[model samples]
Target: MNPRKSDWQNLDLLLKSFAQISSNFIYDLDDKKVAELDVKLIESHLSEAGHDFADVLEHLCDNIIPQLSASRGPRYWGFVTGGATPVATFADWLVSTFDQNLSKDGDSIASEIERQTIRWLCQLFNLPDSFDGLITTGATASNFLGAICARQFAGRRQGINVAQAGMANLSVEVFSATPHASMLKTLGMAGLGYKNLIKVDCLTGSESMDVADLAYRLQVSTAQTKIIIASVGTVTATDFDDLMTINQLAERYDAWVHVDGAFGIFERILEGENLSNGLEDVHSITLDSHKWLNVPYESGVFLTRHLDVLFDSCDVPAPYLAAEGDKPEFMSLGLENSRRFRALPVWMTLLTYGKQGIASWVKRNIDCAKLLADNIAQSPNYELVNDCKLNVVLFRPTCSGLDQQAADEKTTQAMKAINQDGRIFVSPGYWQGKKVIRAAISNWETQIVDIEIGIACLEDIASKL
Candidate 1:
């Protein structure tokens, strides 16, 4: 029955539902059909039609739970990381139950806790304590924020107010040939046309911006030009640009250095205590928790040394809303005025497992690729495109007689053949204009056996092709 007013008793029902949701994540996958569920159900029933909260729970248990569980389970390694640890999942449930407003520290306990969370995160990644970071929607928004901050930081240097004067008046370039899709979004959002931006020649076998090319461009580039973006972990091979070199080049050019390290910053924990050399030099760095840290869904961490620059880029003074106070609220932070409680899950993971745990999980995936790449190199049929430095292993079957198109077709055919079986899933993508299978091992739950299954599946498909 519908409650007359606020329905304070609904909290009991909500906790009950939350319990079931948490319990669903603990079980291993099985072949048995998860109750009687529609394989292609699409319609949602109205409350009057008997699709109550209980019915919805049944539907989730019978449908959504099994699919995501199986699709993203131990043997699944496609696209990139999207696995939720058990503790992280529980933390997410707590956030849902409390429903704490996270936009400002004045909202609730969760808000203040978020401040503490960011402090720990900044320390964990060795980000400057002075460098304040806000949890963004994802890496794409994080990249956009970094781009905006770069524009502002650079504009201020040139005695121009970018916050007051938009990108309409400025001529800016990202200075990257191989940039993440978010980089394009960043530029496009900033009123910089993608086509107008220069694509400097990449170093070799990748789209990573070249330091030498950057230096040459800076030598010729005029004074009014905007920022240059340096990449850490190219999407294709997870290749890292020489950030040290890029910082030096940007310094010479007087361009703001924005580092797009979405999945790359986690590499910081793996490579000794100093993850990013000269990161403090860069104006901003973009981080993605879902990719490497294995959080639930889209959660991005954007950190900048110059907090005033970022604050100016996204500050909104609602005279009626923000009270005149000493402590600037989080709403003055970035693009989001109403932010999600994403910090709960992320903070929980870091607190429960610690940095070493995440570092170890990342190492397992790296080791898997090392083993897989070595195996692929030894095999007669496969050709390793490059050295496996991180978790990604890009390789193609050695189609000796086939033409370029035919070779690509073979790779496509191989991917289709393997995915049809549904035991494992891998996607095909281009590398240096050549068709290849890019196996990125980033899921925290994925083990050595899962990697073996994926390798066997790839080999089996290739042999048949």
Candidate 2:
């Protein structure tokens, strides 16, 4: 188990094998992004219990390598996924090597680096200096942290500590127009009933919420404690809700505002962009560095202006985890007591690629998305479900003399046809009563050629249908 016992020979071998596998995986994707996985049963023979590292590595290369999907490739449009940069990938390797416990008391360097990264992120998002944040598992955990903090903040206003007293006879209302599913899951996990989420109506013919409808909902809500969750970038359509208006309504209603920026929060860095404007006014925010920041998986950020309330919500006093002087202890904050050095990759990414460098890729992805939507719009076989905003293009297959149900079936079939070919991948979901294909371009490697390839696949699939 210890590579050092072999004088680091096995470690060198493993490193070389990793490099080879990475090279092969990237180059092999030229033909296809994914291969059909062979479903097989494992052996139960006791004689095959132990194997050398070299043998195990060889087995993994042969069996597991080809079966994996190239989700980090340019043509993987299945979800809003980001490809890793060379520097960030290397930093991730160092993270695994060091395996440092990122607490405030011990290994203060890791905590200081995390705080510095937070400061850089604030500058990137143009947030105020008074805000504090933490890195979590992903958007789900980030949103969950925001929800729990909002719950606690609301409960405290009523002189109730929900974390200690639980949600016993306490009434707290939540509102969201087109929240990500993770937000609902957060509410459920935070002991707030999912059914209690008052769904606000979106604007006519768009996913953006209607400000008037939100105002009306808030005006009529009887709950003394309220939470309003808004999305800066939705997963399906990549549509941005009216953040300025939502925050205004929240202020009027005396509600805590939480924005799930997720992958789209980077749009705030773009100049003259009014989509996510005033997002900083919210009480809390959710950001996913793994999506647009090109960081590895399980990297998310949750920022809040209410640091006192956040600490009150998740603080757990321990005997040995005391903080020194004014240093903040992360174990008393957020979900986990022991977390990986997740901040290293993010810090390295920001340091290596400055704010302008990262913003360029974001703008590029947005442009590529527009190109995809334009191509879809020109094709007679497909109908654009909505206007392209940010980096998502929502569209579906269409045919003459077909009813709505028939069109829906054709749209779904088109998705299957394209994905089955394995040249590229796109996701399918319902949007405004129509089954639509969602092509999101968040990967740094995505280019106009990738969009062209995806369009070609869809056009061929539409021809057969």
Candidate 3:
């Protein structure tokens, strides 16, 4: 064994480490501090410190979390992160203590717990009871698997043997110019090259693709086009695309409609039934629990309408695995054969707070985002960029005669100034070729005062500029 953690003492130490990490209310959460502590460093030291994970983690706790948490402590606005709920954090510790392996049907009790949790997620989103779900690393990998499932469905329809012989009569286009980076990366994973993406005059001519525009594009294109990836939350301002409209387009063209709802799935669960008009139309969706649900990091979920499609995507037959006439297995459905019970913390959070509490948590940050938008809209020298669709607000300075590049530079300076001041942190992004500050309000613990003070902090920085 590399470093056998024998009993509860090690687990207690682990819990204490996390608790100490959480006690620091003011942390930056720097991306660089994390980048420095990657696998190469671990692999380099694995031989040197064979039975010393405790020592390894001790070093990281002393140097890493302290410096890294600083990045996200100042109103901490980047990549739609949510401060971990206390119940969820505790549950995560308990889960690690248990050390569950959530892979197979007969492997362990952890499998059943995760299976139940998957069912809970399906019900939470009002998806079909028969749907298959898996907890993944994050939405990126989850999205890729969903796309792969779609690829399998498309190939099976053509009798092409794509998993073995590979895709041929398909261009595998996104059909929308405005796609998340996941689309490009998913294209690579699905054996559909990025060059195959057919930009359909989106992110430029229209905010979202209309049915007429989609039909027109598909008319010009051949049957080689197989998949059409759609976005639930666009990266810019968390604005949700019209899925009902996209659903119609995908159906008429017989293209697989995979909805990349990484950060946006909570909008359906937490926003209630009225906000989700036609959510059931998409073939599949991917969710990120860490973003809005606030259950520590790396608890992403993938769900599909056709359970068979999901289960069939990773069909593996091993003689030692199961008997010739055993029950239908769940592990065969996902990307991995050996996975952690990552669902526990999420399930624990849901079990503790229930749906209403999660709704309140999501709404609190959303209201906070709206609060900042109203403040930004009222500011004299600032210009509001886009509608506060979900928990993201986009704004920029109203300094006239400045080129887009210069405006972007000014926005960057404004963001850094606020961060360095150690009061607030906001990220810079582009919207319609204009430079803007993007504030993502997904943190469950972020207060109303944080929003007010953050806006004031922005005003202070802008005044200096």
Candidate 4:
């Protein structure tokens, strides 16, 4: 009996069983452990002669599924992770079933769907029709795309094509006050050494860039070509750089402005927020659908008005691949020649929820963060590290009667204790040279009740410390 043919014969039954298993896990996510695993037990399952597909499925249900981290759960406050909505999950499954390589048009409707999704995203963000974009594999790739465009634009200004000439003798200066780590990695990948990043001074007691300092640096800088990476929402504090002033400075200095709005762009959906007022003036922007859009993993987008520069930077002249014409040939716009139909989930989620639903989700998550911050402020055991900005709360456990060093150590201990408690999950980091616990309220499922639970877990752990 050939296992492959046998599995094919029973595909329907196998798929049904798989769906049931997935449904059970998602339905029981609230009660499941946040994270659990035994490395030795997992290693024991590996064998040279694999079991039948049915046995493998049973093993996954019995062993692997139980040990996975429940990052999709409502109480997961780490890493700014977003949980997939039901419709989005369903759309993702459809994407897999269709399995279209969304590199070019004329093959399938996937390319058209992606184009429409991009246009819809632009409208949702109030961006002008002048902007064009392509979906990518999360913020890393999106930022990389932005960097590639910036490199091409800068090189063109110097009468050289960096993509064709390579980065042998050219130097491009990048300025940023609080660039995300991924942006730095993008610079490195784009042949502009990360070490060359000119660190502009941030505003006092804030992660936002200081416009005056940036102007001063730009005035003094001698680099022929420059790029400015502006942050819409910083990771640790959720603070936004002054994009309006930054764009003015970029214009004065003839610098290409790239806004890394990965998770921060959603904040614009909330009424009365002007943090992203000058977003349209920027040359390019990066947004992560997985972080705040409540979609599945590995989805992001890079938008730019300079489509010509993006094409010149990333396009590969191959006769087999179609050239850009009336429609976008996605392969020429960014990385990945054979790309997944990631836009389907985004498109479906947007269609189901519309703008109002997304706005409500963002506002609720911000409210949860604010609730946690208020609780931390009232508690004597924990100190609020920063004012709750957007949807991230930064705080630390107060260790009375201890020196600074000892207090920092205690903060780390408290963070560990809270994570180990498993009722909720939070991450540890340093804020202004002191240890802090960062609770990033990003999941659409997260609510005020989950924040209350987090506060309780924090209090319980702080009491022990």
Candidate 5:
């Protein structure tokens, strides 16, 4: 028999083995080391004639699994990652099994499911029905979509078809106060040149944009077409820009506004907080599902009110892929022409856990972050860098004997020690010119016990340092 046929015959056994290994690894994740690797030894396993399917699975279990980090575990606080919900995980497996190409609308139900999911998401965020959206790979891709639409809007304002005629000799002015790194990367990738971005002065003692400064700059600006990026959540401190004021300024200046609400848009779901004050007034928005939605990786969504501009920016006309009826093909919406069924997990998770369930998750995570922040505030060996806002806590190592530079060094060392201890995972970052450790508590699985474990890890590391 051929290799493909043999593998197909043994698929049941392979799936059984995979289930066992995955269950064991997840059960022991709390006690397991985050990562264990020997690069040279792993490299030695590569060979010309590939091994059998069973042997390949065995090799993966033995060599590759140990090197992987438990980033999906409750205590993994690095990169603001989220754990996959049970229903989402099951939906993801079905997505892989079905393997539907979601680019076209007429072929399967995937397109409709995606459409409904997008509608549901818009409702969840209190967006108007006029907003059109598409699922993308991640926040970077979503931000790229927003950039493309913004560029298109700017070009249209200047009487230029940038997609067809090119950005030659054209300059679209972009402004942001504390823009995310992904947005800057989008500027470069969108051919706007990262150097063209105008860095607006932030509010004193805060990462949020200074409205008066922004107004002054906009009034004095000479560029005909402008795009303003408003941050929903700053990376280090989780500070939010004043979106209402920024949108008002955008309207006054005739600028296209894009809100990078990657992880912070979920804050809107919580009651008594108008965090997304002017979200509905913006031209475009970028939201990440993998971060706070507690879905698996490779899921983000970009929404815009300018469907015509989006079509002008992203559509590539072809006779073979002609538009069918009134519906727009998913392929003509964003970067990828062959999209995966990413909306399944999101749809399933949303259905399984309605608005109330998601709100509870967000509230619990915010409480957990506050709990950790309180511990850090009361500790003598650590300094709380920023007030606990939403679900992120920033802090650094500090002692009476250490100077500024010495304290920075100690923070770095302590961060390393805590991560190496492997009971929990946190990331190192800089806040306001000083090195700090940032713990982003976004995972649905994270609880009070996990926060306590993180606290214990920090205390132990501080004592050792």
Candidate 6:
């Protein structure tokens, strides 16, 4: 409500300031691996009077910006994270500026953009055109949608209408050899208790699920609604379960199969690789664009072969939505009612970097992982808990002449040191009853040199400990 003449000038100043900060941050990213996270929290309440946008932005830049971890940097290898590509970043800014609702009735063109992007994704993943999908917040949300679909399908098998009747008093059996934690949460959200998840044992000395155990479970299970959760890429170790065998069992038992390919789905892009050979036959699959696609956060995909099942389970009709009819209303198909233009970045990314370009980046990451894994395997001070399959290396520092408890402590301390060094970051995990460090190389910027630096950091920390 200040001078109307000053409004435009002030807006321009704020925009330019933000743009400069963003540009400079990206430009100097290589030099600063991690931000200075030494600032204290601002606990004061909001003021009654609003301040200028420039002042607010300045405060954020001074206080909030430095606390964020540099996950986009070359050596920031943690949590299967990836940095957004230039094309995707630009598209995201456009999305924010346009502020389109991506629903069919809200923005027809934006909705069509999302549909076209979904088609591109299907082609990129080598999936069938008949399969239907929607962009989600992340793998967790995708898993929940997939779970709801499975719940509805399984309830119908037993002459129960879950969508209409709700999971009031139904018992559907869910099984998984190595389900991600998100999958468990999905089951709970779908009204299936977490305690009800029947664990299927893994194959001996391997991270892959035990096909024999799965077959036996299917043979003995009396439940009409059986949902088999298989891992395309496990979180701890990047090992893929035997999808072909699991799908065969599912087909025999008339069960719904859900595969969590959160990060490993990109392995299909690798040359001479069939990482997802039988994935197309599964009932549902979860993929994350933010992980290996090098896109920004809040980008996930939930795809299903059972189009009718998905539509029947998720469709909620309203008087206003009736006219929208037949056209794809993302709100009607998935969880969120008001969705952002999440498709812009994905569409731009796919258009900018076609199959070959994406493949090159993915292959480079896998090669870097192999380089690190090879170095870890040869080092006398470290040993791998699991073989490097895809791009995750699970290894631990060796504490000679120490008990198992002491060795685990030493490994944890080494990981803390690496993270504290601010040059690189790696997470910790327990695999097959052994404590280990998990180094995932999914970032597009990660290279062989980064692998060398990561190894040097690990070795230096381990030696000091």
**Cα TM-score per model:** 0.90, 0.95, 0.86, 0.96, 0.96, 0.95
| Candidate 4: worst-modelled 10 consecutive residues by lDDT | 37-46
TM-score of 2: 0.95
Q: What tens-digit string does per-residue lDDT give for candidate 4 at 1-465? A: 998898589778868996898899898998876755233355665578878877788778787788787898788888788888888888988888889998888767889899999999998899998999999999989999989899999989988888899867666789999888999999999988889899999888898889899999999999988899999999987888888888888888899999999999997777794788899889999999998998999899999999999989988778878665675588989898888999999999889999999999888988888988999999998899899978888888876688879988888788778878888888887788888888898888987778777888888887787
lDDT of 3 by residue, 252-353 (tens): 778777777777777877644444445677778788888788888778888777767776677666757552335445567777776777888988888988
- Give the clashing pairs for model 5: none
lDDT minimum window of 10 residues, candidate 6: 30-39
Residue ranges of candidate 1 with Cα displaced over 4 Å: 1-26, 30-39, 43-50, 62-71, 271-275
Local distance difference test, each candidate:
0.75, 0.84, 0.72, 0.87, 0.87, 0.84
Pairs of colliding residues, candidate 4: none
- Which structure is stronger by TM-score: 1 or 6? 6
RMSD of 5: 1.8
**Candidate 5 Cα outliers beyond 4 Å, as residue runs:** 1-7, 35-41, 399-401
Flag regions of model 4 displaced more than 4 Å: 1-8, 37-41, 44-49
TM-score of 3: 0.86
lDDT per residue as tens, model 5, 265-364: 9988888978779999899999999999999989999999988888888887787896776977888888988999999999998899999998898899
**Lowest-lDDT window of 10 residues in candidate 3?**
30-39
lDDT of 1 by residue, 377-435 (tens): 98887888878888888888887898999989878877667666555666677887889
For model 6, the local distance difference test gives 0.84
